[model samples]
Target chain A: MLFLKRYLPLVICGFTGVVFGIQYYVPHKASEDLLTFINDWMIIIFGFSMILALASLFHVHYQKIRRRQSGWGFSLIVFIAIIVTVIIGIISQGETVDEKGLTSFGWIYTNMLVPLSGTMFSILAFFIASAAFRAFRARTLDAFLLLFAAIIIMFGRVPAGEYLWSKIWGAEFPLQMGDITEWIMGVLNMAARRGILLGVALGAIATSLKIIFGIERAYLGEKE
Target chain B: MRSIFHLLIFLLIEGQAFSQELTPPKELKAFDAPYDSGNVLYLTWKGMPYDSEKVDYIVYISESEEGPFFEIGRFKSNTHFKADKNWPAWAWKRTTEYHYFEISSFIKEGKEIPLENGKTYFLKLLVTDGIKQVKSNVVSAFPKGNLFNLLKLNNLIYMIIFSVIILWFIARAKKRELFLRKIPALEAIEEAIGRSTEMGRPIYFLTGRLGMSSVSTIASTIILGEVAKKVATYGTEIKVPHTDPIVMSVCQEITKQAYISAGRPDAYREDSNFFITEDQFSYTAAVDGLMVREKPAACFYMGYYYAESLLLSEVGASIGAIQIAGTDAEHQLPFFVTTCDYTLIGEELYAASAYLSKNPVLMGTLRGQDVGKGFLMGAVFIGTGLATLGTITGAMQIVSFVLDWFKGF
Candidate 1:
């Protein structure tokens, strides 16, 4: 019984896997209908999962409030926000995404969310500048090459480099540099991208094979 | 009996005369030419000339100079007959062999005529020019190859290059001497964990938005296990927030295992690995909140990420955490490059755990990747040089030919 309980899901998954796999090669109408039914079931399962997650969130925060924890006030604030949003969303006949009905959600998202998110994201600009200053020190040959590449890329992407060089060398120099930049990006970057893509492809294939063959079952969690 | 016999003999004689005197339409050669592809020939001929009164023309084709011909295709009672294009659509399959074609005209009350294949038959065209019949001289031509079969040879070069790279990697991996550089994002793991331990603040490790089985996520989980072990040994707090339930469960197990391995199983907290909402923005918001509230000393973001990368990293930075991020998303790399203290640019994310763990299997794979990269670099150099030299010297024709040959499907 214990073995059955533990392996039951795996067995069902395996059966479904084989069915779906073979369905690809089966041109019959019945096989197509079966695959469609399975796809619909998957969507329903995803919906249920979402509901369960929301419930978990509610339970956790509600318990925090009931216990009068130190963060109970914040929990209350969060609970009220969620409740009001849900209520407005439901009461508006679920058409809250429309222009007029979206006022409340839109206000909250724009005022409270977008700015905070955008501000957080903008910090990356400053961080990049600092990191570049420190990390691009050319400590080694590889570092120097990386720095050179970065400089060329930055200059090539912007128009100022061309303008400055065009004035210095009359005209042809900037054009030559532009050509070099294009060559670097087209050849060097494409090569690197291809290499990375190939590795990713192989890794994905190996991992997928492991999953399909049941060699990797870490996602099922602990045996018990 | 004599009257019946007289009627029958009269009818029989009339039918025989009609059969013998009726002829196909005249001037069957004056039709318009059909559309022509390079390999297929389509010819449209004028209707037979004999059908100016009450008959129509039927076209026929044959493969020899002799008497048998049959109808291959048909058209309406118009001034044209188009040859089928599919008959000779390829140059190699087409022959200069001569074939015969003819047309026949017939009226409703006249005798029915039969057409055969492979023999030239005289054809007469009949038309309702509203009054009488017109005849045209017969014209003929042999059917031959059309122009549609020119081979598209350009894709072969790409196939050759792709195969060479793949083969080279496999061969090098088998030999086992491919060198891979250490990724710095992975190198900072110990330092980040040690710093968090010393500071008495919990360490926060997020495996970005990828699910449990993604390569970057797997790499993150492995590194998380290692980091969790160190934290457990030092009796430091560790929090792992996951966007995927499956990943949360896996991380919990890995964390527990790590604690046990470190001989500090008692310090393991199962709840430390918790699932946040899977919505990209919501997860980022939740994680940002966690960072603000917990103010972890060390923050690690390792997996696949998108726009939320900057948001999470920025929050970590604001919390003054020693932030280390690794991902394979090229688009997100710029954000990570700016915000994270250490960022792994593409394949480096996969290389990180392998580099740190020094697992033989993973190392072998990394070696394979390096071999692939080297082969790609060599190809790039050769291709670029050829293209550039070709362009400079106006030798683009040769370059194009070579490229076409090498690039294969």
Candidate 2:
């Protein structure tokens, strides 16, 4: 039982990982067909997994309410939101959940979900300001450089920066703030970003190799 | 007698008009398209009438060299130079085969010509406007797919070479000592946990919004196992609020295992690792609220993060928590760097897990990756030098060959 429970999964992981990794290099029709078939199965399996997660969520909230935890009211609200949303979703969706159908589910998503998400996202503006204020302190060489770059970027991204530059330099200053900003972002930032991305790619490949060989099993719960 | 003389004069005028002739197209050729399925036959012709108004071209295809040809397409002169574009979809074959093509013209007469003569095959041009028409020579091509594309052969070679190198390094690294540079963010994890323990406050871990399938999340989970073990040993309470359900369940097991391994199984609480919400901002809001209310001494943000990175890190900073963070998300690095005490940049996040755990296999793989990267760096430097020399000397065959080889991949 223990072997079937643990070793079996690892074996399956190794087999699938190797097969899919090799599939990228193959251009044969049979290889492509098999890849497509497995991808479909994955989607179906993911659907089932989501259901399991949903069950776990409900159970967590149910326990919270039952035990009268500190935020039990919020737990009750979560239950209400989920149940109502699911019921409306199934009822309004005739045969499919595609937005092409004019349904109350779409209405709920557009009106309730979108606005709520947007409101929450808009709050980031204030958080950015707060973070910027703290980050812009010039205590060290690195800090001073960061502060300078941040100031230049902030000024260059808007029309006001260009307008101020033109007014101060009589329009012949040779470099506009916007142009400087564009150069900094396009040349300096892009170059650094690409270098980091290359390293990240190599790291990802190594990690994938480790997983395929079953060397990285910490994610599988524990090291044996 | 007078009517007969007028008819004779009209006949002579019509004969004179019919004497005009069209020049036949020159240097017509046909061949199979390279690097594709055996379906396409390419045909090219020169000497299309640049004026185009005097003559129009029609293309015909035939199965055999002899006999019946059918009109595949027709166009105004100069409309198209290549006849390959008109390969009929119905004529597409799985096997490499041959087809014959003919280029002909239809000269317009005073009367409207139907353009399609009922006959299936004939190499004849019609004269219109009382003019004479001409036909071009027929062209034949045998199209077939090659067994292998030389264009993509380099890609296969590179893949094999890289695989061998990585495997060789891994084998070597397993038995020998490999030097690894220090990552400050990973080193601070222990100090952060100890601080939390001394402060008598809970340590909070925020796994990013991504699920377990992402590489960053996988890396983060490995690091989490180490952190949880340390927390268990220190007897500090730890809270993990997850945005993904599977991550939450996996984390719960990891925390439990850590506690068990620490010989403090009684101290482990299942409720400590629980799902908050999957919605991005909602999860961020919940974490922010937790940071304000619970005020954890140490907060670790380790995984793939996006817009919510700044929000979470700033809140942690505001709460005076000892914040340690790591991710492969480059854009979010600036935020984490500014707000968190220590930030792992790019690949450092990946290296952190293996570095902290010191698992022989994981460390071996990391060393192998370094070897691969070193090889790539050497290749880049040498290739750049060779290319510069090649350009200066105007002897670019070697550089071109090298570039083409790399481009294939």
Candidate 3:
């Protein structure tokens, strides 16, 4: 049991990680075929894991119902939703919509899922404004700089800013807010973004090497 | 007077020569495409003038050079130069004078036929400007497989060197203590759990909306192990809602192990790491609803995130939760910084695991990463100096060598 749980997994992980890592540099047909084969297996595994997910879901909601917990009605709703969706999916042969019109699965998905998702997405607009209000309070020098930049960007994106600039300084003004905005976004922002990207890449590499070498097993539920 | 006479004479001769015919496609050759399986051929030709907009080159392919060649492709002249190819700067000279084309398939009567390995194919190039067509001699090429992609040699070499550096550091760290600089977010974990425990409210930990395949998600799960262990020790409820089932399963195991390691095996709850729906915003909506109702004391968002980052973090902030977020998503960093109490920027997300655990081997990897970053920083500084000097001084040739080398790196 220990071997199956611990050593075997490590060996498999180490072997596959190193193999795939090397496979990236090999342009041969065999290596490419191996990648395709492994990807197919992953897809198969993902399909099988859905059973475990559904079982967990059923267990959680079932317990809530059995105990007659608060908001047990919601748990009951979840159970009904899952069952209805699954039945519709299986009966429709996994097709959401047919040639003629909406199938049973399509009716549920188009009616229930899409609008709910849209509502959630629309909430991001309000969140962004609220977050921006917090961020642009100008409590510190950094906040002030952020506020300044944000104001400039907001102005530069519109034609009114250009018109005001031309009115303030003649048409032949050497500097423009548009140019400054471009410099900030293209030069300053790009340089900082590139630095962060490099750090992210290096970090990813370090973590991957740790995993492949078996130095990182915390993800395996191991202590170190 | 003599120069004008010479110019007229030259114009008379050159004009007649130009009016007679267009330049024929010359030195047409086909070879196996490099850095690929033996399934394509790269064809190169010369002799067409760069400004010839009206003229185009037609490429034909066949098994035999004698007859029955079919059209593979056709394109305008002065384009598809070798200099514009996608190969790395250091890999080839990329002769700008020659036009090149990659032909992997031929369409005959609307049916596509692919070139195969172990097959010798003949190709011919013809230059035409609506009226005149000039044909080049046939060239044959045999497609053969390559064992390695030399184009990615620099990438492979860097990987190997970085791996050796990390391993060396790991070995050294085993003998001596390695110093890991402070990341404030790692310190905040214990406090957040304590607060949650005191309030008797659960701490929400999300492993972002990514699967097990992503490195960010993997890092998040590693950090999840640490966070869950702390929660278990504090006897605080830790709820992990997952969008990916595989990740949820992994987190469940991690949570269980953390409980066992904390000597609170009975506190482990299987439903703590539950799967929400996979649809992105739907999952966000669900998590938002849950947070509003339950009002968790602390919220930990770790892993890759999308636009929904602000939505989740804002809700946490509204609930007065100590929201600690970590992700490598640079675009969303600003939102996290604005909303969350603590945000781990980019690489710090990965380093949090090592910092919190203080395991020598893992810490060594962090040290190695820092050193690697230092090296990159030095290279970027020198490269930028040289490039700026070249641009300002108009001595581009002096910097081209350095710039191209840096570009390859």
Best by DockQ: 3
Better of 1 and 3 by TM-score: 3
Candidate 1 lDDT over residue span B1-409, tens digit each: 9999999999998886565343444333422112222112222333332322344444444334342444433433432333221232221122222112323322223444432222233332232333443433434443222222133223223333543444454445556645667677777878888898889999999987876446678767767877887898889999887677666756877888788878898899756776667767767877888788878999988889987887788778778999888777776776677667888766666555546655444455555455545655675677788889899999875665544332422
True contacts kept of each: 0.09, 0.46, 0.81
lDDT (tens digit, per residue) of candidate 2 on B1-409: 9999999999987776554346655555666554443445555555432324555666666555574665556655544533233322222221112223333322333332222312222342221222545666676665554334444666667666766666676787778877777888888999999999999999999778787778899888888888999999999999998887778777888888888888899999878887777788888887888788779999999999999999898989989999999889999998998899999888888887679877565677677677767866787677788889999999775465555554533
TM-score, one value per model: 0.59, 0.77, 0.93
| Rank order (by DockQ, best first) | 3, 2, 1
Worst 10 residues of 3 chain B by lDDT: B400-409
Q: Per-prediction DockQ, in order? A: 0.09, 0.46, 0.80
Best by lDDT: 3
For each candidate, the alpha-carbon lDDT, in order, equals 0.61, 0.74, 0.88
Relative to the real complex, the DockQ score for model 3 comes to 0.80
**Relative to the unseen true structure, what is the C-alpha lDDT of residue A50 in candidate 2, on a scale of 0 to 100?**
70
Question: What is candidate 1's lDDT per residue for A1-224, written digit by digit as tens?
Answer: 75674577567656775666555444344565687897797677656656645655666567769898656787688779878877866665555266555556666666776786676567557756665775588998977987899899887777897776677877855365577688899999876766666666544433333345443343333211
| Clash count per candidate | 46, 5, 0
